[model samples]
Target chain A: MNTADIKNEKSVRYHGVGISNGCVSGPLRFFRQRRKMGRIRACGDQREERARFEQALLRTREQLDTLQRRAIREIGKKEAEIFEIHAMMLEDEDFLEAVQGALDDGACAETAVERAAEKHAQALRSLGDPYLSARAEDLHDVATQLLRQLSGERPDGDLSTEREPYILVADDLSPSETVTMEKSMILGFVTFGGTPNSHTSILARAMGIPALVGVGAVSEDCDGAYALLDAAEGTLTVSPDAEERCAFEEKQREVNDLAREHDRYLRSLINKPAITRSGRKILIYANVGEGREIAQALLNGADGVGLLRSEFLYLSMDRYPTEDELFASYHDVVQSMQGKRIVIRTLDIGADKQIPYFALPQEENPALGFRGVRICLAREEIFKTQLRAILRASAYGNVSVMVPMIVSEDEVRACRVILNECMEELEREGKKFDHGIEFGIMIETPAAAIMSDEIAREVDFFSVGTNDLTQYTLAADRQNPLVERICEENREPILRLIEMAAEAIHRHDGWIGICGELAADLHLTQRFIDLGIDELSVSVPYLLGVREKVTECK
Target chain B: MKEFTYTIEDPNGMHARPAGKLATYAKQFDADIRVHAGEKESDGKRLLALMSLGATCGTELHFIISGSDEEAACEQLERFCRESWGRGE
Candidate 1:
């Protein structure tokens, strides 16, 4: 097996779909599935065969129970549920009956279990539902366990003898196989056949291990070879030369440093304020789409919910969501924030984000057409319902109302009138709400940026929606691939508009924040700090990185 | 015999989670239960059997119960259908 001297060998590169993101270098070890040592001959005694089958079932059950407990401890309960389901499948009458019938025909317990599993697996495959059919693999996992028990074979092959962590190479891995192995001993995974949606891929992602799947066949001789597995680039290099090895080590060090610095080091500073060197306290918040993401936002250490797009509830429903339904969602999100400032933007749907039930007439350029506050003001009842819900939720926590797409003071005053009516209605109904909840507007349109001075006085704060501002200011449609370069290159004009809004809002003693894609751009963190932006709100994943960038900035 | 029909509203349909839940729940009943999905039918007490029915979203499940505990089983199964698969939203 020691055919090639790894040091003198030329490097071999293999490509596949990168299911997880990371880079690792190690000696490659092929994980071979432990098959039952040959065919099982029928035992003459039927009762003895029955006893053997029963004992194997009992042992398999115990092993599954242990795996379930270990999985729950190491991984999450959600991932561990597969083991619970497998345990249930063990006692499934169809499976047990098939196995018993095969045993009655004088087949050994191993053959009986194998045949029964194949029969049920074939039946499941013929069902034609892809998700259900995938359970065949799970069924096979259970059968393999049973066979192992009957044959008294070890759960895994002898890879535990290796001293250092090795890259696990296999044809594909079952969920049981992935979970049962010691994750600490494995650096990464390279599979010959699997998908991004495979159980192994999902487990690898959940465990934060780099993996490449569906890479086609790798030679058995490559085993024990020094390798570089960079799942970020979806490539595995075997027996890399000195130069290649140097490059691989450099990349691996950078990835390791980043994972350690950003995830561990930055996460330690999550509760700390994202204060700049010049002593500007820039609040870091998360832009979440729905109530379900509130937990994630909180976990990522968002100081507040900066931009809660209210369109999710409306878009999910066939008709408009009722005020109570909207209130239920908003109430949960607000309560979860636990008195942290949560800015809930009213429904900003239009031609691009049309709810079929809205039934607005199609326009030539929907972006320039009636949208945001225009649609809300046109439909006062919808706007009022949302306002009432937000107001109702204000009683629980620090909630704020932020209007979207305001081009003029007229639109601001119009929304104010409707908001006041909703407050009055709430007052009459005796609903307890924060009477002095903060009000703000999204500075998206160029006209809104130009008229920020007049608009800032009416609202408590301003949050610049830079995605829309960039497209509108540059006269470039963001979705157009042809003008994508134009949109990407032109940031100075958008930054200037944001600077104007920041100055105007600060003049009124109201703070300004950027709740846009640009907010997370670390390149502009120093630029944004210079412009006197009070807050930055990005998606949950970028929260920590942006926080790190803010501290890195002058 | 007690019988009722329910359309699977869960987008993923009778996958492992729901099927296992159904099998586990049906095991508690003394009544003989059978679930039918389109042309295929399965013993409600078995997880693999229920899964073999391959019921996807929009597939109607006709549940038939027969035994001494049929009435209680019928009522409970109906409630489960309304609570779990009932959200036609």
Candidate 2:
């Protein structure tokens, strides 16, 4: 059928959640699941059922051995070991015991294998290890192979049989299946079912491959058809018309060019300072979530880390992370930064970033009530532990402590008292730390902005957290659709507050920085420089873009 | 039987690389090896089992080996723990 007829037949477009950024147009290679074989109930005899299972195991082992070798040559040694891991899991004594136990209980070999695999899969998943949980997929793969062999079903076709690099369209894929593929031949992934948090989603994101998940079924007639898999928008257009194909190709090229441009152009800017046309040198720093993001920030040419949101450590764990655990993570980040400034925001939780262990009381307005510095000031032990950890990390790098959501000079003074006490404790323990490490406050409230002149005198620096400042100043919820215009039209008020904070911090010979989404806004780059803001910190991805914008600005 | 304990030093804990290498190493000897981390006990020869222990940084792992080559297994695996495991910290 022609493109016109194909477009009219059934639904040509499928929608799903995009896993990563990118797009691809290629032949749709459907990863067909093996059709169910007729189940022949075993005679409830031990010998016969055992024989069937043993034979199935033998077949599976041979098949895996061949696949392992082929995969080694195709993908490389490291990825090929996935097959080897599967083989070891297949023959593990504990797993075999479960499988054979079910067979002994008169269940057929197929059901027995499925039940055993599910149990072990569940066990692995409960471990809370992302990689180990990913191994649960290996269990399912091995079990399916064994089941297929027991009923004398043919194995799935080799992807190499296809000539072109194909977009893998499937009902679903286990992490094992996703990793084991010849990643080069796989253009992208489109699955009929998978949530954003599914194992396949994790794999796709890790692999940096474009993927669309939860796209409903495609008709068999459309198999092997030329399709556009635009994961940037999470749409699959099958048998696209000439115009659609041309448009998709253009968009794909734009994405590729921009990605490559960011790498090549950004690498050149890494060692150079971000200087505006008028010789105003702006320090472009990064706002990172955790320690791992620090490495990427450094790679992207961050002058330093302006906002290390320390709440992530609290969020990722069940209970409060021990001071030692927190110290280890912070130390690694500090050591890697190599004397660069790392302004760590101390536990900006109790707002949207809630922890169940903290048991924060439910409020009508969580953002305004019992949050940030207020919570930290009330929960002395938690605040002290974090302060101690930040102090310890200061020994490794030029680490600064920043208090979030401070509305008064009193709160700043109180934090300084705790800060000095932490220093005293560290000193008493004979800990080698930077005693002169700068302490700062985040100007995130209208009250904080109003009182910036007084607050700046209490701290060594000021970082205007514009996201919260904007919302607070305009009295409009950022997430509320009805107040979009209110937030949109209120940029001038927030900038004026930043100007006040910058001026206040400057009066005391202290540096002021902006570490929020507004820092990445190209239009605001010039105003920030003109306002004498010392540093502008956005996320890692915007490090170069903001730097480029700064150089372009007068 | 011969047994020894080693603490996890890697911030990533007993992830794929260390677990896979530990499994491959444990399989070479004629010994039955078991590793206990917290409440989880894993067959040392099984990669997934070793990883399933969910041993984070500073987790103490006790390796128990029995059979013909228990002594050799302990010596080599202990060295592996010191050298290969918990690197890049």
> Considering every candidate listed, which one attains the maximal TM-score?
1
DockQ, each predicted model:
0.30, 0.11
lDDT (Cα atoms) of all candidates against the true structure: 0.85, 0.81
lDDT of 2 by residue, A265-299 (tens): 86798889999888989899998876766877888
Candidate 2, residues B18-59, lDDT tens digits: the string is 776788789888899999987889899886677678888899
Tens-place lDDT digits, model 1, residues A12-36: 7888888778899899999987554
lDDT of 2 at A483: 57
In candidate 1, residue B51 scores what lDDT? Answer: 89
Record all residue pairs in model 2 with backbone atoms less than 3 Å apart, i.e. clashing.
none
The TM-score of the first chain in every model comes to 0.60, 0.60
lDDT of 2 at B77: 92
The collision pairs in model 1 are: none
- What's every prediction's RMSD, in angstroms? 19.0, 21.9
